[model samples]
Target: MKKILLITILSLLFFSCENLDDGIKNSNSPNQFSQNFGQSVQRDFMGQVVDENNNPIESAIVKIGSNHVNTDSNGVFILYNVNVFEKFAYVSVEKMGYLLGSRSLVPTNGINKIKIMLIEKAPITTVNSGQTSEVNLPNGSKINFDGAFEDENGNSYSGSVSVFAYHLETSNSNISELMPGMLFAEAQDGSAKVLQTFGMLNVELAGASGEKLQIAEGHTAEISMKIDNTQLATASSTIPLWHFDEENGYWKEEGEATRQGDYYIGNVSHFSWWNVDAYQSMTTLNVTVVDGENNPIPNLGVTLTDQSGFISSTLTTNQNGNVSGLIPTNNSLTLEISGAFNYQEQIGSFNSNSSITIVISSASVNTFNFSGNVLDCDNNDFSNGYAVIAINNYVDYAPLVNGTFTSSYATYQDTFNYSVYGVNFGNNEFSTIVTGQADINVSNTVSINDLVVCLNSNTINLAGDFNLVVTRDDGNIYTFPNEIIQLVSPNNYKTTTTGSWAAGTIAQDQGYNFSINNLNGIIVPNQGLCQGYYSNNIYGENYNGTSSNGLIINNNEFYIQYTITFNTGPRIYTCHYIRN
Candidate 1:
């Protein structure tokens, strides 16, 4: 369904008849999203979703392989025991008010943490379907449509048409994380090629009632994107345009755009995330991230920016502490790790493939790593087990190999507050998990070993639909009826194969997520009905109350109640799920 809209992500440029310009600056600190995932087992994947502002966004749907999950109030979602292929996975996010966001990454084992920043949709511009109309951006970019629009059913739309348009500034340093996938595209001949973008635009249309609409058959719309002044001297007179296939997450070469003065003007037969980009001559660039000890760092954020604004995107290091992608062979580029924009250097040589190694430095003393082993209820070695490891906010899985496992060792946060649990996979049922934790000043590689565990408990299926209600301190009540929920079972937690859990919340417009432990109804940490004060802010109303199995609700239903404390007072949210 998200393929229907063009996700105009990046440095925001809202369209208007009048100029509304905004300037952007780059920071050495975190720009957009950051990933803290450690060395992980390859079976499960999890992460958080955030908006362009970097705050956690709840209810965003995350799809990977054939599994999907909704972000909890904390913007955290997990997929257990899912399938992955050849070290890479495709991840996509969908929220109502934001454009679709997706990426391709070499996934870590369990607890593959990534923060995806969804670009909020700009306000719609209304135009008559029967008359020519154009929406101009602040920077002089515009999309001109020559009347005659059609609804989704192929019927001509005669009334008002709503246009949603956005332009992405390629000059921004953070463009690596802001754009849709890496600078890669499918050529007119179906071969994949790396892209060096000149400019990008996403155009979308809806009818009077918000149903999908498009330019009439055999008609076309002209897209004019303003070229950055800094690039005009080097910009080509003519460029091939590419359109992103939102459904497949691939950009395809579609049409051509001619550079006119300061803009690239093109006529497009259809709408998608269109880009004026040229195929770059690329060679494989392998980046290895390590610590002072020369150990590999897994899941570290790596960004490659073509100084000329031709190629840019962020990628994460894999389990071997390596990130391998095609980079422009002829252009100079900058490579930064984990949001450190200050460190810039030429990565590799031209023409031939190259490998570069970099170290993650800190103000600390030694390396930081995770390693451990597991035991069963009778103190027997448990080979078929997986461990959930959390060091501060860096949560991930450490899969056991013959009852032992090791993390990708590297520099990490100074204070290592940890929590670990070993889940039994011996019988495909997680009756219990061995749990442990401790706070330590992480000066060097920390290994957790000889962990005693057992299948001491079980979990119930809390998957279904229900009504979620939240009441503010001043007595304002909001009710969301029929919120959907799903929970996959284990030893392997393969919850939903194709379906997505969508809950309606005044706080979480996207929805909420949670996994219950039948042992004590202790839901995953901060995974309950927490939302932000804003629409679906997961931390808005944290459950200060006790836990429930979310079952045994009058025998015919189940429920979850939470109390949130505000500066003014307190409010209670009773998410009462009525059974059929």
Candidate 2:
């Protein structure tokens, strides 16, 4: 039956737009209609429309993009021929006595089931004169409208009146239906009681239609109402008088009501819904800060700011991890809680009258010492200098005046090392070599183990044929011949070779190979060293399998030491080459 109804509606709709310029192409037959839209692969989008209470809402309009469908008695709707590959469809719903709802639906790849909930509109309550009516508000409170009144020569009398009260179902900048701490109170008769009651009066006596009263220009009428014992008991005390501003849809503060024993008396100058509330009452809130394990965290800074943009307060938790404050009733506030030293900060919103507990997590701290010493090539302290350790891109430096320096910093817990380079400014006489290793692990404990580095230099003057003799730790000796060792001058600053030569030697005694005046310089091995192995340079760059070496000249002797570890133990290899 629904299918027939849909086809009929579609046919009628198509015919109605036949003459329009942008009308869809008209189909003369049912087969043509099917061919126009039924050729594509079809998928069914099934869903049910439910009210806020999960009850099915029948006759609601469900629209998917340009397509429209109406829910059946069960509030179930199915859209046929929906393209499954479309990925997303914009769905909107409309129903009488309910707020319009919308949701974006993503096809479940295989499943097309969806559930959409709609909020029902609050019933519009209207009360007539000289009678009392009880209507339940959407927020679970019940309001009783008692008798109406008219002032006849300053005497109160029962009169005809029209009163309208509606709970604004939709929220806007002007009015919000949900107020914090607003709830149904128990009455003396075991029924749900209202926070307040209202009694409206006729503003005028003449020129008014039935049940309606007209007020004179430049003048207004007042509503006289009584407070029942149930309301007073629910409030637990006296409350201020207020009127619901029908024009503005908000509660406005009027003068305080005079509590005459059991009844409170107040005056209203205009016609609208009147209410008695304790908005001015002080509401207390208790805040507690705790860790993830429920342990109390004391001395944490907590701040509360009313979302209404008026009030703010700051306090610190006591030893019990609790802090209490009083706020104006029915307010929502944003709470921010923070602490020092390894505690994470948190911020959220809460009702001002409610007690809440906030959780703070503990953060792990990492501490390590970055220490090393700056020295000369002769193993002497290079006083007054600085050294830096570069871990990835971050750099940390410490001053080394007496050849030793130490500094510490904290980082997150991680397993990593640093690449360090040290330079000593010997009063601008020379600079320490930029040399360091990349294997210092500082993940768990304090580290201050130092690596010795040579920084001093000497001048070289002799370059000639040199015989190299190697000695192992076991006193085994090996010799290599036909090796060319070059000693370059200071003016030839660019050298790319390794092996020891002569330093600080005058050309008059040693003969001129490279000129030098007591300045230590580097050695260059112009040919390959031992088959195909080239020495590693100062920079940490690898070329094939060739490794470079560093040399320091001291005590008029050449000291070259290298370690080769094979499986179990390290074999120290030393080489001594002489030019005479």
The sequence of per-residue lDDT tens digits that candidate 1 reaches over residues 193-310 is 5567777787778777878888899999999999977678778899999988765555678879998999999999888688888764556666787666677766566667665554
Error of 1 at 3 (Å): 24
Off by over 4 Å in 1: 1-100, 104-123, 136-141, 171-182, 189-191, 226-237, 259-263, 290-293, 299-311, 330-348, 359-365, 372-406, 412-415, 420-580
Whole-model lDDT per candidate: 0.57, 0.40
User: How far in Å is the alpha carbon of 129 misplaced in model 1?
Assistant: 1.4
lDDT of 2 at 102: 47
Per-residue lDDT for 23-89 in model 2, tens only? 1123444233223321233444556566543444555798764577876433556565664223224
Measured by TM-score, how close is model 1 to the native structure?
0.61
lDDT of 1 at 53: 42
What lDDT score goes with residue 15 in model 2? 9
